[model samples]
Target: MGARGQGRPVAVIGAGAVGTSVASALARAGRPVTVCGASRRIERIEVTEDGSTETWPVAQATVPDDITGYDTAVLAVKAHQTDAAAAWLKAVSAPGTTVLVAQNGVEQRERVAPHTDGAYVVPAVVYLNAERTAPGRATLRRVGRWDLVLPDEAPARALAAELSAGLMRVGLEADFATVAWAKLLGNITANPLTALTGRRVDVLRDPGIGTVARLITDEAVRVARAEGAALSAAHAREVLAWLENAPEGATTSMLQDRIAGRPLEYDALTGAVVRAAERHGIDVPVNRLILALTSAIHPGQ
Candidate 1:
């Protein structure tokens, strides 16, 4: 099936870097697409992946009512913006529709299910490193091979087929919990550390900071295993290594939010790990401290 999902319309919520990139991919695949809640009204979306650029014309809708008959909605808003984007969720979540949540953190279903009107929620582990350069422009800085990881379910498989276009490669994993938790492990450490220090990806190479990151990841690994995510100490080390080797001068979403003076997404990233640790009676001093400090810096959360 196409991105329209058997000829039904498809909509992308949020016009941030990730949203625009996905929209560009779908449009490039000859799928009928619409973008809702764009930061600005634009007729085109431009995404530069690696060193190549692709542009596609898209229908832009500012209000939920303007978009109807959408069978698939790719939600790309930040964790903190979920509540604010609830209206768009309701609009596209017609009965039996699928909402593909392309956000950070592992609690994508929990965070989004409440807002949808009984629509099927498919959580996606997004691996794309996209940055919005302007209103309708984004750059996909390649950090890994795949762009998304979803559960090995019918909805996910269908969604993956529709999204296999351009640079948007998708993977279906039988053990999605492990994949989600592993991705969270990287974000739980890298995002907060960079935001707090006002530094780029290379800051993780500092000895003292590296030690703190390891501690945070170690604690999170315990939480992940407790939550049945098959994580180990070796995985923690791998997370640190991946971040340390990321392109120099690369900024995390949390660091970008700090620079823009917007609310940080620590609650969903670090805060989620802390919450799970509490349930399992696990002591997560590093993660808890990082959560506290990052929470203080966020605007409203």
Candidate 2:
């Protein structure tokens, strides 16, 4: 604990690529960190530039019971898995434990709020594209800072600094809603398109496929505005530009889930846009089609 004030251990709820990365970052910073989840597999991780490499053990525990005594918990599970993760947090952690959500989409904080006892729920919008290449190996596609959006209050800033210090680069944003919506704008396009077409992100950026990407992003931008998230058209344009410039070999998480035949976070990424469109009384025809296509591809999801 660097600059510590009540040093409760840090727990990462899911040891997937994102969870492992966060846990490794904290553990590298000399914090007491444990990763808890149902997966019993052990993983060997090598952290970036910090020379932190360790064999990470995944603790076995079921939902709503496994979450335990850590002062800070980072929920890095997929968006659809958030409810069960929240329930676990409620059963395990004491009140006032900070819960940081490191998932895609904008609804994780809201989803986790009902279960936890008014714990400081920090909604983080992740930017780095990390993937589980093997059981214990994950590769980082982007080396970017983690952006955490919380109130400017002392507690929030202090928590941000504590979580960020000596780990990955962390930035505090006053308008967190805007940051989340902007990240959502980026995620909404690549994920669904890649899942639906079974194409890698590079292939999806072709002129024909690029049009579909634009359509989905445009609809998400509209919904973000309707929800008062303060995103702009330029954000949507930038999303497209990023897609065009992204590594051709890169595959979205949705694509990975589809190939593995595991449940996808469709409900959060693309399905979220569809729900938001209905809420705003706006037409999201392209998004609806993408959702249908992706869902059809994953039948029974």
Candidate 3:
């Protein structure tokens, strides 16, 4: 079915930067889209791309009970916020629905499967670099080739075809575990350090910080390989280079959460690496230290 074939609205959970951007893209492509969030009233979602901002008058539903229908849904909340978003997931997901988990970490399927009733949950690796400047507003800073990467499966292929008309592009990969782990390497390296230092992507330019980032990448690469992802030692350097080359002053989701005093998502990024390392009996001192420091910053969250 195409964008308008089934007459079913596409639900995007979480009004954060990623969610707003995805909703805006799909809406611009003429797909019926509903943005379900925590807002008490309908809000105009705006996304700025290539110096131009556009507002989408998509359907809005804030309450979980109000989100009772949708054939496809994107769960864009942070890993730590999964519990809070469970109600919406349950309301929109059923046997025929397709729920795409667009959050961080390598455990997207495991993290979101329980929340979605009988709907097929597709794990996605989001490659977009956008930030929620304010409520209902997000700016896309990078002009990347694809916004999401998914496995080469029937569900993922169908979702990719659905999004083909939008600004968001989806790539189907045969080895999705490797792709997810590669992205996770970027997260575990950039996120924890940036949140801890209260800096942006440029912080990796510092020699000391760069050293720590490499150490973190090395550990994560090892853990990712152990977890059946095809990552190499050279991939560590490539991940660091990618982070260092990001747009100047670009902020990560973890850094944004830190600035807002919200709970850090280190448990998903750094915590994922550490957990895998423990299971494989690998030594990852730097990753363990970063996880501890980030978790302490927002204790009990």
Candidate 4:
């Protein structure tokens, strides 16, 4: 179960874009990794840099009852899929298993805690812009690094160091809350706006769309402030400015889901904002409108 010395058996629960990318990086680092919860068609072509891949032929990928004897389990599934994935973790994971959550949003640890049996749940903020171009192939749009937020534990730091040594950059930050909220602010601007307008990130450069992007950023900043997360107006503006400079054809994941007719993460991203606004006793009409529009388009949730 343990990787003698520095090596560890890593099981990636989801073989989506993020999951495949992380599994590749871990394999490149000589960490024995296996990807589960994907179709055999994808599994056959799920080639890591080190040429290691496994096809988990299971109907419910979130169920971990079939997965066994892995040191670390990385949950790269969607936010809504976390509950089912956690149920599987509880069934299969051992006490010493380390669960690294590489999904977006700030509440992943909370969502997975109930299903884990005393496993260390480490929250991580991934910064790579990866997209699945094919069933098993993912294109790395931006080779950004990963920022990890770990509990005050030595084993967590050791794990971070090992993963950081891979291809992309990796860093551990003491103020994990700030790091997470910062990424959320960026996501708030790019995701919902693209989903609502059916435009790419560069659409923000248009003066009319730019104004809406600013509004979204402004509301997110207010909610973050109300949540006691230290995010400034300047930070929000910086996020908007970055979107303005992004590629003209850079569509967000939400937009991509819309094109593919899959369920979007509107509830997790924009819906989270509404919940946060309620907690702060602040009304975010702009984000509320965006959320409503996106939800209307999908109507799957």
Q: How many residue pairs clash in each candidate?
A: 0, 1, 0, 1
lDDT of 3 by residue, 52-150 (tens): 999977677867877675678888999999988888999987777788888999999898878886899989898889999887789988634678898
Ranking by lDDT: 1, 3, 4, 2
What is the TM-score (0 to 1) of candidate 1? 0.94
lDDT for residue 44 in candidate 4, whole number 0-100? 30
Mark the regions of model 2 whose C-alpha exceeds 4 Å error after superposition: 1-7, 43-67, 143-155, 299-301
Candidate 1 residues 1-301, lDDT tens each?
A: 2334444557888778888877776776666668887767788888886688878878888889876667788899898899999988998777668899989998999998789976889998977777888888898776776788899999888888877854478899999999999999889888999899999879999999999999999889989999999989998888889889987566788887888888999989998998899899999988889988998995533
Question: Candidate 4 residues 232-286, lDDT tens each?
Answer: 9898887777667664355677777777777788777778878989987998999
- Predict model 3's lDDT versus the native: 0.84
TM per candidate comes to 0.94, 0.86, 0.94, 0.86
Clashing pairs in 1: none
Could you tell me how far off, in angstroms, the CA of residue 191 lies in candidate 1 after the best superposition? 0.6
lDDT of model 3 at position 212: 91
Better of 1 and 2 by lDDT: 1
Off by over 4 Å in 3: 1-7, 299-301
Per-residue lDDT of candidate 2, residues 118-224 (tens digit): 57787777776667766545665553345345545565676666656635656777877788888887787888777777788876568888887778888888899
Mark the 10 consecutive residues where model 1 has the least summed lDDT.
1-10
Q: Which ten residues in a row have the lowest lDDT in candidate 2?
A: 43-52
